[model samples]
Target: MSVLRRVGMTLGLPVILLAAWWFASAGSTSFFFPPLSEILDSLVEEWFGPRLAADVWPSLYRLAAGYALAVVVSLALGVLIGTSRTVRALTEPVFEFFRAIPPPVLVPIFILLFGLGDGMKIVVIAFGCMWPILLNTVEGVRAVDEVLSDTGRVYGLRGWSRLRRLVLPSASPQIFAGLRQGLSVAIILMVISELFAAENGLGYAVVQAQRSFAIPETWAGMLMLGLLGFLLSLLFRLVESRQLAWYHGLRRAQRSS
Candidate 1:
C-alpha cells in the first residue's frame, strides 16, 4: 500500500470511533455520558494542570521501574532456562503453575507481605509482566541454531561473548516480541494495582473522581491512562524498529523477492 493509504488505514478506525462518540454524546445530559468536549476540558484542566505531576507522573514512574525490573529478571532467568535443558525441565512445571494463577488473585498476598506501598505494587506489576517474557525468551533461545554455537566456539567466542555475539542476536526478534507483551501486561498491572493499593496514580485519581461524581474528571483520568499506554507502546515500537532494523531489512528483501 502507498504510505498515505497505510496511514489512512491505520487512523481510520480510531477517527471513526472518536467522531461517533463526539456526535452521539454531544448533547448528553446523563452524568455518566458527559459530552466529549467537557471530558476534553476536564482532561486539560484536571490532568494537564496539576494531576500530571501528582498522579500521572507517579504512575509512569512505577510502570517504568516495574517493567524495567521485569525485563532484567526475565532476560536473565530466560537465558539460563533456555540455554539449559536441565534447568528448563526443573522450572517449567513450577513456572507454568505460577503463571496460571492470575496476578490479581495474588494482590492481597503481596499487599500482606510488602504492604500497601510502591514495593507491593511494583512487585505485582513485575510478576504480571514476567511470564510472557520468560516463555518467549526460552522459546527464542532454544530455537537458536546449533551451527551458530559451533561457529562461535570455533572462533573462540566463549561464555558471555558467545551469548552476546551469537545467542542474543539470533533470539532478539522473539525476545522483543515478549518484551512488547510484557510491556502491555505491566501497564495493566500498574493501573490495577494502583486502583487497589496506591495513594497517588492515574488509577487512584480516576477512583477519586468517580467517587466524587466528577464523571468528566474520571473520564479524563482514564483518557490520560489511555494516552500513556499508547505513547509507551509507540516508544517501544520505535526502539524495536531501531534495534531490529537489520531483521526488518532482511524481511523486506524476502517480501520484495
Candidate 2:
C-alpha cells in the first residue's frame, strides 16, 4: 500500500503540473509563453518526431562522454587524495579555488583554448563535475570507521587491497552522492557550452529557435532539456539504490538504535 501510494504520488504530481500549466498559459500574451496545448503540439511534432532525432543525440553523446570521463578521473584522483593526507593537504586548496568559480564564466576561456568543439565541451563538463565527486569521495574516505581500518590491518590487508576491500565499499554511498551532484553540474555545463557558441546540441537548437521567434519550438527544446535532466537524475538514483542498499540498511539500523 505504501509503495502504491508512493507510485501514485510520483505519477500524479506531473499530471497536476501539466494541467496547471495548460490553464495558466491558455491566455498568455508573452511571446515566450505560448499556450500549453500549442507547446505540447510543437513538442510532439518537433521534439518527439524529427528535431529530437536530429539534435538530441549530439547533446546526449557529449553529455555521456564528458560525464563518464569526469567520473573516472575524479574518482581516481579523489580516492588518491582521500587516502593520502599529504596529497590532500597539497591539492585541497587548489581544488577549492577552482570549484568556487562558476563554470559558465569559463566558457570563453574554454572556447579560446580548445575552440568550439567536442574537446571544449568535454573539458568544461569534466571541470565542473570533478569538484563535487572529489570532495565527496574525500569525505567518504575520511568518514570510514577507524575500527574497519584496524580490522583490515589486523587481517593482513594493506595498501591497495585494503582500499579496494574496505575503503571503497564503505565510501560507496557518499561517492555515489558526489557523482550524482557532479553529473548534474556536467549536464548544465554541457548545455551552456553548446548554447553560447556551438553548431550542434539541443542548446544550440533552443537558441536558434528563440532567435527565429519560433516560440513553440523553443519551448519544445526547453522541455527536452528538462526531460533529459530528469532522466539522468532518475538513472543516477536507480544506480545509487542498487549499489548502496547495504549502506542504506545500515543507516536505517543506526537511526533505529
Candidate 3:
C-alpha cells in the first residue's frame, strides 16, 4: 500500500472517533465530560510548556527504566529456567504463585520497602511487566527443536554462539509476543504506581486535576496518555518489523508454499 493509504487506514478509526466525540461533547455541560475542544486546548496549554518537562519527562523516564529492567531480567531468568528442567521444576511453583498475584496489590508492599519515590514506582512497573515476557521466553526456549540443537552443536556453535544463533532466533517469536504484552502492562503499571503518593507523573497530574475539579485538564491528561501509548505501540511495531523481517519473510514463503 502507498504511504498515504497506509496512514489513512491506520488513522481512520481514531479520526472518526475523535470527530464523533467532538460533536457529541461539543454541547455537553457536564463537568466530567467537557467539550473536546476545551480538552484539546487544555492539553496544548498545560502540556506544551513547563508541565511537559516537569511531569511528562519524569513519567517517561520511569517507564523506560522499569520496562528495560523487566526485559533484561526476564530474558536472563527465562533462559536459565527454560534450558534446565531441574531449574524449571524447582521454580515453576514459585513463579506461578507470584504471577497469580495482581501487581497492584504489591504496590503498598513496595512503597513500604522502597518508600514513595521513583525507585518504588519503577520496581512496581518492572515486577508487573516481567511475568508475561518471562513466561513467553521460557516457553519459546523450551520449544527449540532437538534437531536444530544437535546441528548447532555439530557445527561448534557452543555457549554464547549456540544461544545467539540457535536458541534466541528460534525463540524470537515468543519473546516478541511477550515483549508486546509486557509493554502494555508496563504502561499501565507506570500510571498505577504514580497514582499512589506520587508528586509528579501523568497519573498524578490527572488525579490532581480531577480532585481540583479541573475536568478539562483531567480529560487532557487522559488523552495524552492514550496518545503516548499509541505512539509507543507504533514504535514497537516498527522495531519488531525490522528485527523480525527475516522471520516474517519465511512465514510468508511457508504460507505461499
Which has the greatest lDDT? 3
Instruction: Give lDDT tens digits, candidate 2, residues 18-82.
Output: 89999999999887788988988998998888776788888888888888888898888988898
Candidates in order have lDDT scores of 0.91, 0.87, 0.95
Worst 10 residues of 2 by lDDT: 6-15
Q: Give candidates' CA RMSD values in order.
A: 1.7, 1.7, 1.0
What's the best-to-worst order under TM-score? 3, 1, 2
- lDDT per residue for candidate 3 within 75-136, as digits (tens), equals 99999999999999999999999999999999999999999999999999999999999999
Candidate 1, residues 1-257, lDDT tens digits: the string is 69799679867887898899999999999979899999999999989998889988888888989998999999999999999999999999999999999999999999999999899889989999999999999999999998888888899998898899899999999999999999999999988899885789988889989999999998888888888888888789889999999999999999999
Candidate 3 deviant stretches above 4 angstroms = none
What TM-score does candidate 3 get on C-alpha atoms?
Answer: 0.97
- What lDDT score goes with residue 198 in model 3? 94
Runs in model 1 deviating more than 4 A are 1-12
Error of 2 at 18 (Å): 0.7
| TM-score preference between candidates 1 and 2, better one | 1
Q: What is the lDDT of residue 17 in candidate 1?
A: 88
lDDT of 3: 0.95
- What is the TM-score of candidate 2? 0.94
